[model samples]
Structures are given as C-alpha cells and as structure tokens.
Target: MIEPTHYLSSTVKGLKPSGIRKFFDLAASMEGVISLGVGEPDFVTPWNVREASILSLEQGYTSYTANAGLLELRKEISYYLQEKTNVSYSPSEELLVTVGASQALDLALRAIVNPGDEVIVIEPSFVSYSSLISLAGGVPVSVQTSGEMEFKLQPSDLEKAITDKTKAVILCSPNNPTGTLLNKEDLEKIAAIIEKYDLLVISDEIYAELTYDDVYTSFVSIDGMVERTILVSGFSKGFAMTGWRLGYVAAQPEFLSAMLKIHQYTMMCAPSMAQYAAIEAIKNGKEDVLHMKKSYRQRRNLFVNALTEMGLTCHVPGGAFYAFPSIKETNLSSEEFAEKLLMEERVAVVPGSVFGESGEGYIRCSYASSLEQLQESLRRMQRFVQKQKAGV
Candidate 1:
C-alpha cells in the first residue's frame, strides 16, 4: 500500500497541530472537566448582532458577498479603525474581509513572504504564528519575551534578532497566552527598530477591544508605521462572534491588493450574513464589548488572586483574558502540571511550553469562563498544588 504521508505537502506534513487544542480535546473527552484552556469568550453574540444576521437570512441574503466582502461592512470597519486608532484606510482599496483573523494572518504572510525569507515572531504568543509562516514558505525567528519585562517584546532583543534575510515581524499586543499589552513607550522603541530595518509588520490586534485598564493602541497609529504595517483585526474576540468567522485586513492599497488576489482565489469572500451582522456589531456593539470586558476583568482578578494565594507567582495581566502562572514551584514541567491537574482534579489548561520554549514553566489559564467556574477551577488547582507539594 502507498504511504499516506508520501502525498502530503512537505510544509503541511511538517506542521504540528495547535498545542492549545490538544488539552481542549482531552478535556472534552473527560467527564466533569472544567477547562481554562481555550482563549474564547463565553458570552453569546449580542442579541442585536444575532438578530441582524437572522434578519439578513430572512431577507434572502444567503448569496456570497463580494470578493472583498460587503462594501457597507468594509466602510464600517474603515470608520471604526480611523475613529479608534487614528489610522485611515479606504474601504474600496485598502480593506479585505477574511474568514477570521486566522485567514487575514495567512493572507498577510503569504502576500509578503518569499521562500527562505525570515519573519520575526514574538514568543509566548498565539500558537499558530510559526506554523503559518512555515506554510507560507517563510522561516519564523522566535524572539522570546519574559516575565521580567511584563512579557513585552524588548526593542534591544528584537533588534539583535533581525538579520539581512528578515522580511517581516509579527506583533500581538494585549497578547494571547500572556495577556500582556505593549505600551506606547515600548511600541515607540519597536517602531524605531522596524523603521531602521525597513521591515514589514503584521500587527495582530484582535484583542485590542478586550483591554482591561490602559487605552489600546494600534500599530498603524504610530508615525510612519501605517505605510509598513498590515493590521489584522476582527469581531471574534470583541463581539463574542467567534463562530461568525469574520475578520479583515487593513493595509496600503498595493499590499492589500496582493492579499485580495489570494483571498479571491481561495476563500472568495466571508459569509454574507456574518458580514451584515458585523456591520451591526461595528456600529452598536460597544456596550456589549464593554460589558464583556467588565466581566473578564472580574474573572481575571478572581483567577490571579487564587493562583497567588496557592503559592504560584502570577503576573497581573494588563489586558486580554488569560492568567499565566509559573508552575516551577510544583517541581513539574508545564505539561506535567497541566496533565496531573486534569487527571487528579479535573481542571484543564494549556501547557505554556507549547507556546514556545521560553514559555516553558508556566501554564496559561484563561479567564474567559464565568466567575463561578473560575472559582471552582481555582479550588481544584489549589488542591492539586498542595498534593504536588506533599509529594503525592
């Protein structure tokens, strides 16, 4: 019999499945498991947004949207970005809607990366960056950010990591896994480095609207940065619309045109009803986002305090909905800590090591669940930690 692997594309074959999903899968199979693993909002899409989608369907709007998505939706996105981030993009030429931020990310990488080109990835980030780069025929250079600097990417380290082959840098602020947001000061330093090196930037700002404390800043808002940055954002995290499968990219017309070509050939367009509903989301979803953010803030406090009281060192996350606590005190690897917690106490979390080697010794606990669920998970985790310390 012919081997199944023989027919697989070398790039696709080399890619590892997402580490975040592995623990989620395990938790799904187990009875009475409380999962803090997946970074998804627990809130349902706001009724108005859902109603708008339903209304669209009732009005016989099931046909495929334009290749660039609905003109009205794109215009709403353009207006929102300009008003919120101080960045402008022509809806007609500079914006392209995608299936999700995932597709926008893929499109951005594919449009810019060439074989052997290097893309700098800040580590302890979303798990897909390196794999996506590899699939685009680009090399991903990992730049590790540590707890010492609040997990913000250091300009000095980033400058040292760049080489002649480097083509682009991927940045996620209000970052996943770590929940650290880069401040304007830190971003200014990074902007200097990118400008000095003339590197393209793919700024993943999906969590921009989920920030807890400080005002969120977009990369394109910095001086001279808009010309070089491709901004990828969406309604998934902010609007509690993950299932809607809608996101978009904003860039200069020349760059967006290239991504549009790829999107037209592959995805063609995002879902029609989702696009219509997204217009409603962009226009009227502020209160819903604020309500969700308030809830997440309470949950973040609940989890972080619980972790600290249990003898784990946790940095208070500034934004997003995750609490990454060090598990080194338990004398187990991140995987060991997570697995034993799941088996013994029925709580699930993603091992930090899977995010990147620098993330090793910590486990990411999402606060996207409710307060009661978070409290229960914390109770189970506390018991698990005590048992580990007792050498059981």
Candidate 2:
C-alpha cells in the first residue's frame, strides 16, 4: 500500500506538535505527576455564565447563530471593548465571533496573508503564531525579545525585522509562556514603527483581563493604531470558559469582512449556547474576573518567589498565569532540565526552546494550578535543582 504520509499537505506535515502538550501527554501517562505545562485557568466557569448556557439549551436554542454570531453577543463585546480600551467597534460590521481565539487568529492570518508575504512574529510567543503564519503561506519572521527587556518588543528590534515584503506583525501582550505586559509607552513606541512601515498588526489580547500590576491597554487604543489593528480575544483565559470554545475578533470592517468570509465557509458560526454564555459573561462576569485575577496574582507571587529563592532567576510576570524562569544556571539545556524534572521528580513543565530560539535556557511554569499543587511542585523542583547542582 502507498504511504498515507505522501498525501498530507506539506504545510501540515512541517508543523510540529505543541511543546506544551507534549509534556501534558507525558504527565497524563504517569502517576502522581504535577503538571504546570498548560496555561489553562484552575478556576471553573462562573456559575452565572454556565447557567446561561444551560438555560439556552433548555430553551432549545441549539440552532446555528448568524454567521457573525448573535448580534446581542457582538453588542456586549463591543461595549466591553469600549469600556476597557476606550475603542469602539461597530457590532454589525467590525466583529466576527470565532470558535476560540486560536480560530480567530487562524482566520485573521488566512484572510490577510498571501503567498510569500512576510509576517513578523514577536517571540517567545504563543507556539501557534509561526505555524499559522506558515499555513497561511506567509513567511514567519521572528523578532526575538529577551528576558533582559522583560520580553517587551523593542521598537528598534521591530524596525530591524521589517522589510519591503513585511505585511504585518503578531503581538501578544500579557504574552503566553512569558507573561509580559507591554505598557502604553512601550506600545506607543512600537506603534510609531508600525505607522512608519505602514504595516498591519494582529494583537492577541486574550490575557487582558488577567493583568496584575498594570491596567491592561488594548493595542488599538494607541493613537493611529485602530485602523491597522486586528484585535483577537476570548472568554477562555479570564472567564474560565476555555472548554466553551468562544472568542471574537475585532478589526476594521474591511479586515473583519475578509475574515468573516473564511469563518463562514469553515466554522459557519460559533456554538449558539456558548455565544449565549459569552453574552452573560461580558455582562455579569466582571466580579468573577476580578476574583480570578486576584487569585492568579497571589499564585504568581508565590510561584515566582519560590523559583527565585531556588535560584532560577525569574522575572516577575505582570499578567497571565505563566512564570518563565531562566534555568541556565543549572548547566542543563531547557529540554534536559524539564525532562529530568519530569522523570526524576514527576513535575512537568514546558521547555522554553519550543517557543522560539530566544526561549532557550528557560522553562515556562504555569501558576494556574491549585495552591497546594503549586507548593508541592515548587518543592519538587527545588529538590531537583539541588540534586542537579550537586552532580549526584
């Protein structure tokens, strides 16, 4: 028989599996493993939000929503964005609901990228950015951001990465794996370069509500950026609604319309019940978000403090639930350290190298687990570090 691999798309064939899930799968196969690999929230979806979805099902509202999603949910999303970022999107023309923020991102890439277009991706970013860009037939140009700079994209570095073929930039503030929040001044500087280059921006703000020390600023809120920004966010991170698979994208009508064409053909619409729940979430879930944010802040402090005490040299994360700590002092590659920790200590984390070249020498530990689990994992990690140092 002919090999099935011969039939696979070259783009799909070239894509590597998610580095985060590799450890998660290993932990699943083992006994008594503590996994800090995945970035999901530890909290459950708020009762009110879940109840709304349940009620929708009871009302037999399981039919497909409009291709763009329910107008009510879109209106709520518009209001929420305006309230948070002082940027308003017309619910009818500028918003498209997607299965998840990931899908929204994929749609944005598919809509905007043409063959040979170059898209700049800021690294150590979410693992999917580069893959999705490649699948969109665009060359993913990585601009490495360092822990020395708090993983914030420097305007100079971004300028260096741009070229005549560069079409857009993918930016994730409150970035995954690193948890870095780019402030207004930082964004203003980057925005200047974006304007100078006449490039578009795909801003992933999924972790906006999880910010700890500073107020979350949407990239489009920067002067002269609204027209060029495609804002993708969802209910997963903040509202503990990951399993619900609900997210939305906000952009200018031209971009949104293009994405909508792809979304309509592929996804048709987001789940009807989840859309109902999202409506409730945006309307009444502020308190729930605040509660979860407070818990994550506390966990971030505890986890980062423990990592530092163990000599891991972590930068205190300003948002999101991850703590990216340097493991270079241990004299081990990130993969070696993470593999040894999992095998020897049954504590699972993602080696940062999988995120990008700049992510080498670090490991991403999510603090989204329970306090007790986090404490136990930290103890195990510390013991593992000591053993590695002692060379026994």
Candidate 3:
C-alpha cells in the first residue's frame, strides 16, 4: 500500500491562517456577539454602482472578461491613480485587475519572490503579507514598529533590516490593525532606501481613499519611486464593495507582464459584472468613500478618546478603521486579553499577536461596525477594565 503523507506545499506550510478569522468563527457560534474583528465597511454598495452592474447583466455582458480584466476597468484605474495619486500607468501594458487585494498580494509575491528571497514586512500589520510571501517562496523579515512612534516604521528601522538577500519591502499605509500612516518625509526616506538598494517596493494602498487629514498619496508619487513601486489597491475598503471582489495592480510594464502571468493562469479574471460596476465606482462612486471616511473618522475619534479616557493607551490612527490598543495594563497576553473581552463583555476583537510576535501586547478592534455598536463596545470595555483594576 502506498502511503500519501500530508505533503503540504513548503511554500504554504509556514503560513498562518488569517488572524481575523478565528474570532469571526467564534462569533459565528456564539449568540449576541458584537464583532469588531473584520475590517470591512458596514455600508452597502452605492446604488449607482449597482445599477451599472445591473445594466451590464441586462445587456448580456456576462462572460469571461479578458484575463487581465476589462479594458474599461483598467483604464478607469489608470485614470483614478493619475487624478488622485499622481501615479500613471498604461492600462494596456501595465495593469491587471485581480479578485480583490488578497489575490493581487498573492500574485505580486509569487511573481517576484524567488526561493530564499526576503520580503521586508513591517510588523503589527495585516496578516496576509508574510503568509502570501511565504507561499510565494519568499522569506519574511519583520521589522517591529513602536506605539511610541504611533507605530510608524521609521527610516532607520528599515535601513537596519535590509540585507543582500532582501528583494523587496512591502508597505501598508494608513495601515491595518494600527492605522498609522507614513507622511511625505517618511515615504521619501523609504523611497531613498529602495532606490539605493535597488529593491522592489509593493505599496498596499487599499486604505488610500479612507485617509482622514489629507488626501492619500501613492508612494509612487515620491521622487524615484514610480518606476520601482508596484501599487496594489482595491475597491473593498474604499467602495464598500468587499463582497464584489475587485482589485488591481499598477506597476512598470515589465513587472506587470510577469504578474499577469500568475493572475491569468491562477484566476482567469475578476468577476465580470464587478469590473463593469467598478468603472462606475471609479467614475462616480467616490462620494461613497468620502461618506464612509467621515463616518469612520468619527468612530475612530470616539473610540480612541473613549479608550484613552478609560486609561488604555490607543495610538491615534490617521487612516484605516482600526484602533490597536495596548493590553499591557490588563496583565494578560493579547490572546488572553481578547478571550476575556469576549467572555466578559460579549464584544469580539482580534489579538494583535495573531499578526506577528511584535503584536503580542495589543488587540485590533475594527471600527467598521457602527457608532452605536462602537459606543456600546467601549462601554463594555470600560467596565471590563474597571473589573480588572478592582480584581488587582
């Protein structure tokens, strides 16, 4: 008898499942669990955007779009980048629409990471970067960021981490979990490092449109970065179209050519109607992003202020819809902190340790739910903290 061992792909075995999923599963089983775990908008797809998809279906536009995606969608992305971020790309030669930023992440890493290559990941980040890099046969080197610096990844931190084996540095701005952003000077410093090391840069700008203080700028907007950076962005966070499954990559034509090979072979094209709807989303649905951003900022301010008032240290996030508060005062590990919060408060949040070792003393709470929900969660959290203090 031949034995079939559980020979998982070496590329995938090191990857951890998403940190956002476990609590979500637990929430699924429990009754009356208020989840602040997942990072998706509570808003519905804009009606006008939906109408375009509805029209596309009515007009029999249901079929396999070009493997790279629809010309119109790519072109819209190209235009949006130029108008919004000052980054330009030729849709014909240098763009690929993917099935959300997740696939784009997978395709980008797989396309460039040779075995043993290193991809620098700033820690306390979204979980997918390292995992996808691992599955692409790349080693992940994590650089820890401090809450004292508002979780900003500094220039010296980046410089200290680079080595001969380093192939690329992945960046998530208005970052997940912490919501920290790289200002222009911060971005320029990283760009200079990339220029010096001749390393690839992949900028995850999925949260670009949700910026609070100023308009979001692509790292490619920095001098000398446009040619080396691969900009990965999508409609999920900005357009409230997470379920629609659409994202895109804009990079130098040579790299785009290579990435499309993986995308064309693995996922033929993004959803057909989604491509059409996204065109409307790019052209007219920007208002939806503005509305959502305004709401998220309010929730962020309320939660941040409330948590700080409750004696928990929360870094004021500039963008993204999460607040990563330190759990050190609770005298519990991050996982223990989260479990206790769920059991004691009926509020669900993810442990930061699930992101990486650097996240051990924090928990990520997404404010993407609602004002009322956020207020109630904060109330329960304050009560829980008081109980802990009293118990101490």
Residues 1-392 of candidate 2 have per-residue lDDT tens digits of 99999999998999999988888999999999999998899899989999999999999999999999999999999999999999989999999999999999999999999999999999998999999999999999999999888888888999999999999999998999899999999999999999999999999999999999988888999999999999999999999999999999999999999999999889999999999999999999999999999999999999999999999999999999999999998899999999999999999999999999999999999999999999999999999999888886
* Best prediction by lDDT: 2
**Which is superior by lDDT, 1 or 3?**
1
Q: In model 2, where do residues sit more than 4 Å from their true spots? A: none
At residue 226, candidate 2 shows an lDDT of 98
Kindly list the per-residue Cα lDDT of model 3 for residues 162-234, writing each as its tens digit: 9999999999998987899788888988888899989999999999988898556679999988888888989
Judged by lDDT against the true structure, how good is candidate 3? 0.89
Each model's TM-score?
0.99, 0.99, 0.97
TM for candidate 2 is: 0.99
lDDT of each: 0.93, 0.95, 0.89
